[model samples]
Target: MGRDFEAADHSAALIEQVQEAIAARTTLRIRGADTKAALGRPIEGRTLDTRAHRGIVSYDPTELVVTARAGTTLAQLEAALDAAGQMLPCEPPAYGGQATVGGMVAAGLSGARRPWAGAVRDFVLGCRVVTGHGKHLRFGGEVMKNVAGYDVSRLLAGSFGSLGLITEVSLKVLPKPRAALDTALEMPAQDMPCKLRQWRDAGLPITGACHVDGILHLRLEGGEGSIRTAQAVLGGERGDGAFWVALREATLPFFNDRRALWRISAALSAPLAPLPGQALLDWGGAQRWLKTDASVETVREIAERLDGHATCFTAGVADEPFHPLPDGLLRIHRQLKAQLDPHGIFNPGRLYAAI
Candidate 1:
């Protein structure tokens, strides 16, 4: 649906390239639009760009299933979905660039609707991957044992291409809400969580919630009657819908400061504590974005106290931008990498140091 471009299938060439790289005993740095260049650790390998192998392979608006090549841009997919009156409810961010479908899945990021809807992996139904063995394989999507995309397709969502080359993917979609409204309330960060709980219990069609600088922003979505009822219950001024978009893209004024920004994710009920820096609560207090010069150790310590982990968003601030995995879990990661990439040819050390 993007620009009415003809469907291009470069799987043959892509597989051949993988085979050549494997035979030559070299590594591969998988890139799709390279919009998240500063996200994870840098890799050293031959670039395997997936931008040319583009187009939607199959799309049935009625079935709510879409299959597209990795090279398809997010904007393109969204535009097509928009025409069909549907959307990817996870609301993946474009990061102010031409973010590709593969890159969005690889990053496994979700927007303000994440806590209400679900994460990227939740919508992935299947994937076509080029393994390090140079074999083209398919996983999930009416497969054996894996239900609800619990197999390789879901794992690759946040794998950052460390597992293998994602050539194509199938995702489930949802229809647009019938009605929506944004509301704002001036309340302390500490009290917003309790208020959100009350709304949830009362069955208020809450979809997105974020708090910053004494303002609690809430989005109501559902039937028109529900919206009207929730509006009266909320009793606040009309809020700016652009707030969510700006926050999702990190273009908000809060992110303008030149300091290391840390994303702290804890339980939804985690107590609000005064961080050692400026903090904005999002996801109904499930995620805290902190902009501070605090040492990595100190920031992580605070996160751990809340039974959560902190990931550095700013590049070069920490060697490992991801949270360290437990020894048992880390061993599994290494084993997975070894199984999929026997020659260690795919984005080595991109996710962790050992793998």
Candidate 2:
């Protein structure tokens, strides 16, 4: 159960290596580095390092799509994208220098811009993956609107490498904004829901907005004239100053907790309840990062009541860190797992233990 993982430095080599390992009945704790290793249960297997599958396969700025080996670091990708005046709309967090493209899709960690732009899965056009039974298969393709069949590439996102080892990924990139400005206002915590609803209903095209402490920070982008118009329409609710992005990035004191980190995706109006420790609100009140000692059941019950779910972003052991599946859904998951990996040579019991 130690964090003893290895790296396969090349895309083709990693795929072949994974296939060979599966044929040999080798239990591999597949990983890019160790950034997201704490996400799932520490497997009782030797590590399969895919970090060696690095570098971009292709990048077409005119087409707004980039294909890169799964193990390419997010930092490297971002720098490349910046040079081309483009970025991943998903705004994935680097979370240390080790988080790779594969880990980002598997972990499904999107930043504040997620709601404004789209999720990681939304941009996944295609991928080449090595399945559990030592088979290399290509899912989807390089085209965006090619939904001619099941969207396997998108499904691979958030699958946590439990289904397959992603060798290469094709993602849709977005143009960088021409102008950007941030505004903060002193707003009451209780007024956040109403403010968010009003602002969203207004169609202001605000890039990001979040309430922390007693201040509400909002980000605006696009043409300078349009941003100015937005600021005028926003009225006296705007004040200059504060790094909302860093706070949204969860680098502030509120996120420095060393306890179990639970990410609760619930209604914007979900009443903030007291936990063992502090928490940070983001994504217009929908996403909450809590540092607490509350039992999974306790947190899950609260989320369930509010028509949402809670996942343990960081934790030790829990009964159910993710939202449990009903009988019907559980049956479907089992069927799919059987179809893709009958032997379960992949990350066994990743999303759930019984599976």
Candidate 3:
């Protein structure tokens, strides 16, 4: 009963804050640890800290679902999942120790196993949010088959607080793999993509793949027998699992350079024409990270020509860090933003200037 009372009081406080902001026509920057402050266009407003509203609401290993408050740290959630021998399949990055569940979903950043496992949004089942009008609403459910209407829960993923304040999230979890192995092979940067394609077609259990500094690193996770067979077929010396973790966290030497970093998402079989800087390949050639001083137009043009989009992932080089949307998509975004935040008191101009 005391716990329920505390939760009710917290909710009332949050609603009051939102109502005051709305009444005053004051914009608010919803913050959860601020680990991803460097991402997207910068915004300035009254800081609405969600850190104090932290806790794991529920977890059922058998059901493979864990619901937690927005301010709950990723470390806490992962620890609980680990204890249950299950995991967040998306393998989100904890940019810092303060990384929160809300921030993870909002940023929508995935890790090395993304292509094989899934994305952050894929694991999201439902969420509770406070919209601009200070109305508390819940969209989605703990079960996967509860699909009824618009997937507003998943839509909050990667929204970066533009639409509303995500107060809680429900995520689908997966069991840990029975076995895992890491292997590396020396290969030319250009040849790595084709090799990755061949391995993928061969139906090997590849959870992660990256080519950096003239070395191709592959991570395989599954049964022990499959791991041995894949190692034999791939033919590379064993590598450290920490290597992949560093790669995912951007702590590797390859990511140490201070040049402008651009994340390019292209086809798995996309041909590689030598670009003007150091390159690191991940996502089985679908995601490429380039560190270069090249012009924004040059980088984007090359990516567009390859039938992919490039974003200024780390720095403030472009006016829009994300790919520009067409008129049709932009209209949908505007409509949704207006519906959820009619007064536009949420994180305004964080995603796009017009919204």
Candidate 4:
């Protein structure tokens, strides 16, 4: 909930504007449409909208690189890449269907295909960002193997705009799979924790797996034969609950209800750890989506016992959902933030208090 934020479309113009604001010691909350702005704690500053700066700048299919302004929508990028038979491989879930490319990277939100395809950070080729002092800087390169400097490109992926306001980004895309098959199993609700682990350890080529309500849904993608073979090996019937998988991604009901949502990420084989309330299985058993009436601390404690952490995937109030990091890690984060934004003007207090 940034109260005094302003939206800007031009990157160069934004740099000058933010620089002036920084010189005046005005804290700013950098964003793109505020789609996922509530992801972290609420900030007390001016909100800078990076939307209106949308569109693909350069797309070199031969090099598998697509560069675009930060405000570019994932839908637009995906549709264009789909026509070209290429994709952003990271499988970023469209948060409320309004998530901009910059928002996606800032939040580092990924879908079920993450373990196989890669995380959002992995696909990031490079980025041009505006620092706290309103200085525009570029990191990484269009080429994947280029490791010239501090690897600042990937660092900004999950920084949630705390490090800087990403103005332009270039990502590596991959050719779409030859075929895709959605399949499922009607396993009992209580049996999924074991079944999912068994499937993962059995080495089935499952691209996506989740147990919602009472049905176990799986998505298989590859060559036609490979998809069919994998489906048959998993012994799943053709699915009638494909939409449930989609619901898990955008979290239709949970988002609407504004329940205290908890995203527990743990080992795929982690035992059926007790949760304080209703839970849905997603990303196989590696990720759990919980809707609970308990306090945030209660949910976090449960995750800690299971050797995992809980994050507020989406909620109304701005509060810390993650456990406090150790002093050593905090030192590094503060140092980086200081170097990038000495005045702490970019998304101040967004991720952590001092980051």
Better of 1 and 3 by TM-score: 1
Model 3: per-residue lDDT, tens digit, 1-355?
Answer: 0121222225567778999999999999989888888778888889998877777888888899998888888888887888879998898888655799889999899998999889999999999999987899999999987576679999999899999998889999999999998999999988876787798788789999888888989999999999888988988889779888798678889788899888998876678777789999898778889999998888988888778988887747889877777789989999999999999988898888877
The per-model lDDT (C-alpha) reads 0.88, 0.75, 0.86, 0.77
For all predictions, the C-alpha RMSD in Å is: 1.9, 4.8, 2.5, 4.8
Better of 1 and 4 by lDDT: 1
Per-residue accuracy of model 2 over 1-355 as CA lDDT, tens digit each? 1111332347567667677776787766778877876676667666778777778777888889888777888877887889889999887777655689888887777888888898899889889888876777889877767575558888888877777788888999989987766777788756777877787787666778776777777887788787777788775555453465465345777677677888889886677565445666778778877788787888888777767888886757465567787889888777777777776777777777766
lDDT of 1 by residue, 1-355 (tens): 3333756889899899899999999888999998887877889999999988888888888888888899888888887899999999998987664788889899898989998899999999889999988899999872224465338889999999999899999999999999999988999998987888899999998889989888999998999999999988998889668988898888889889899989999987789999988888889998999999999899988989889999998889989988889999999999999998999998998888899
Q: After superposition, how far is residue 90 of candidate 1 from its true place, in Å?
A: 0.5
Off by over 4 Å in 3: 1-9
lDDT of 3 at 166: 88
Candidate 1 accuracy as lDDT: 0.88
Once fitted onto the true fold, the runs of candidate 1 whose alpha carbons sit more than 4 angstroms away are 1-6, 142-150
- Best candidate, TM-score: 1
TM-scores for all candidates: the values are 0.96, 0.90, 0.95, 0.90
Off by over 4 Å in 4: 1-9, 146-149, 189-203, 240-245, 248-258, 314-318
* Top-scoring candidate (lDDT): 1
lDDT of 2: 0.75
Order of models, best lDDT first: 1, 3, 4, 2
